[model samples]
Target chain A: MSTRELKHAGLNLQQTDPKTHEEAESRVFGFWVFLMSDAVLFALLFATYGVMLSGTAGGPGTQNVYEMKSAFIETLLLLSSSFTFGMASLAMKYEGKASRISVWLAVTLILGLGFLGMEMHDFVKMIGEGATPERSGFLSSFFALVSTHGLHVLGGSIWIVVMLVQLSVFGVTPAVKTRILRLGLFWHFLDIIWVGIFTIVYLQGLTP
Target chain B: MNQEDRAEYRRELRSYIIGLIAALVLTAASFATVHWRLFSAPTGILIAIYLLALVQIIAHFRYFLHIDLRKSARDDLQLILFSTMIVLLMVGGTLIVLFNLKSRMF
Candidate 1:
């Protein structure tokens, strides 16, 4: 396939080695299937959240618990990390330098970690403010949706560490390259979901 | 690779950067709508926020995930469209049913 065609198909064209291109293409396509299904899961959670938005049970409402500044910072961190991961993929494909890829990956990892840290602090602050999930239905769904996304970010972070190790030990093999491309898709997909969360859950909550 | 291939790679990289900028701006707008109360009515603000989010989602899908309606991506696009349909049905149904039940109980 031409580079443009490959990109259109959502497959990275950086790994142009004829031998493994076919396998990588199928693998990435399969991963996309998984991601679409995952989207359904998040959609369901979001729906549940919408249903429970008013179920405060006399507990603290969204305005009392949500911190807009923290949420905004988290958004910036995750979005920037997505951009950095794209750079990592670019380094892997265009530069074809394992060291350069590793550098970008490390930067992405730090940004991911920063996002998680801020999220954890936000959760702690909420709990400290008596906004525990068990305190009300609204809080329950809030925790469920946001925590599920957090778990996904945690999983992606672990995968990044493992991939970094793989890169060092195995170098930029076809297998590693394909894995990085898939990770990039997964990371970007999570950011898309976060946009929904911050807009629907946080921004709407703070709107008055 | 040839010079043409190199140029294509550069173009792809630039697209990703552009996507990053667009996403950031959308996020900022979402925050601004809430913080500044750009709209006097709460419902108006809500509608604006949702519209902004929908656009940002499409931006991410096209620029970051590279899923588009081009010939090569037709299958993937079909799958996404189908999944979106199911999600809307399920989620919309849940809201209607549950909200109706709550109203009846009250």
Candidate 2:
């Protein structure tokens, strides 16, 4: 199908069932609003982190705690997952084949899981080195920010599994498509936040 | 299904691949700048990294999120811009006040 045909398909759906199309559009817009609010939350955490970056209180600072290699790997995993999820969305849009979509989704899920595993390992290592949140203000903010992002990833991973199940059970219903699209936005949003974390928290901390 | 559709799909896929490549290259540059000590001054390195990060954020937003300046995206674009403004005001103001107070105390 050409782009025109795709557009026509959408228009036809809207013409036939205006209610569903309107609902989907509003649902997407609502999700965007939610994402913006989430962004504000992250921004607040980042600001708190910036304030406490040096408040080690005689404890381990970021330089002493962060491992650049693992952080880099985590970055790669998350970025690749974002791309894979994009592929999943494309498959859904173009091929409209549930199997193809599931394959890409599975790849994304694995990458996401890998990222979370690496992050958890990093946290364990930090804790092993006595870099717990209670050690200092800096550690407190660090854990809060990083763990919040990690929790989002965990939630997203769970969402992916749920989506896979839904895809298998319901096929490509309008509701499922809307849900998947929102999930894609959520996944990409996390990656964007990770860019900030790596740049501000890890890279900057490791610089000097 | 048809030739024209296949061509459209290819074009879309190509754009996504381009985006992925750009993001990866930017990420590599970020790591290399620090690992190789490309910039001697810490401040300079920080600035470069921040700039690189800004670009990468835009890349992800444009490619993966499909956020553009097109008419259809206007509402989302406005929402994002407004949220950013609020966040900057709140976070930036808090940091400035708190940091200034800390400096004054010591």
Candidate 3:
């Protein structure tokens, strides 16, 4: 490599040639822009949730519907998945074996699915208990904020699946590597958003 | 891979591990604080949880996202900071205006 761009870019973008490095760096930078915009989107949703916090309309609110056990478990699952994705990224960078990277990716996928399953369970139970989104502005905004994050995770999980296919078919090409880098950013970004959810939405919701 | 390559790989792996552990601690602390009602005042608990979340978010950005103040990553950092500014403005403005209007109405 002409420069330590790979190392500098966090070891995930391991392009060798100068031209390839420059190109990948620019694309990754562009992906950063996309993520920041997504952050803005989520922030506004959070704002909406905050403003609607008291519009429960005499219906069930956070204390009535939220299960701390499940929320904490979901948080752990997502956090672990982020770590696994980081492992997968490292394997992609260093390990010559496609199998190794695929293994870590599969683990990350399972953790992500586990998270989605728990969240789906939570939503199902909430609705079953008459805590539907239509119940109040509060519940509406709650579902809106939380489900949007869930959808992002769902999308990221599908991206992981697609990447697995590409790894098998294309075998770690620069293009595939670039895609992986962006996906890593997306995955970790979701976890960051989860921090906000668990803190602002769940924890804050639990407060008196 | 050379010896140096192996060393670098190990170092990278260590960073992820560190991030994971730190995150787990912060997550547990936030949950515990709420679950146990560690603070008598609701406001105190809220501030504690938010502070924990802030620190954990920064850790994730540094260790997992590999965002630092390094010159190479400076552009990405600027993008994130600028985004934060916009988010603050929009979210902040929305809350201020709406809450003020709510107060006036009631």
- TM per model? 0.96, 0.95, 0.97
lDDT of 1 at A2: 67
Candidates' C-alpha lDDT: 0.89, 0.87, 0.90
lDDT of 3 by residue, A1-208 (tens): 5223453433443446668877888889889999999999999999999999999999998889888889999999999999999988888787746798899999999999999999999999999999999999999999999999999999999999999999999997888888988999999999999999999988888877
Q: For model 2 chain A, where is the 10-residue window of minimal lDDT?
A: A7-16
User: Model 2 reaches what TM-score against the true structure?
Assistant: 0.95
- Computed on C-alpha atoms, the DockQ of candidate 2 is 0.62
lDDT of 1 by residue, A29-143 (tens): 7988899899999999999999999989999999999989999999999999999998888777666778999999999999999999999999998999889989999999999
Tell me the tens digit of each residue's lDDT in model 2 across B1-106: 6786678678768867988998999999998998887999999899999999999999988877767776667788889999989999999899999999999999
Query: How do the residues A124-206 of candidate 2 rate in per-residue lDDT, one tens digit apiece?
Result: 98999999989999999999999999999999999999999999999987788878888988999999999999999999999
The positional error of residue A146 in candidate 2, measured at the CA in angstroms, is 0.5
Clashing pairs in 3: none
Evaluation by DockQ, superior candidate among 1 and 2 = 1
| C-alpha lDDT of residue B80 in model 2 | 90
Provide the global lDDT of candidate 2 against the true structure: 0.87
Candidate 3 docking classification: medium
Better of 1 and 3 by lDDT: 3
- In candidate 2, clashing pairs total 1
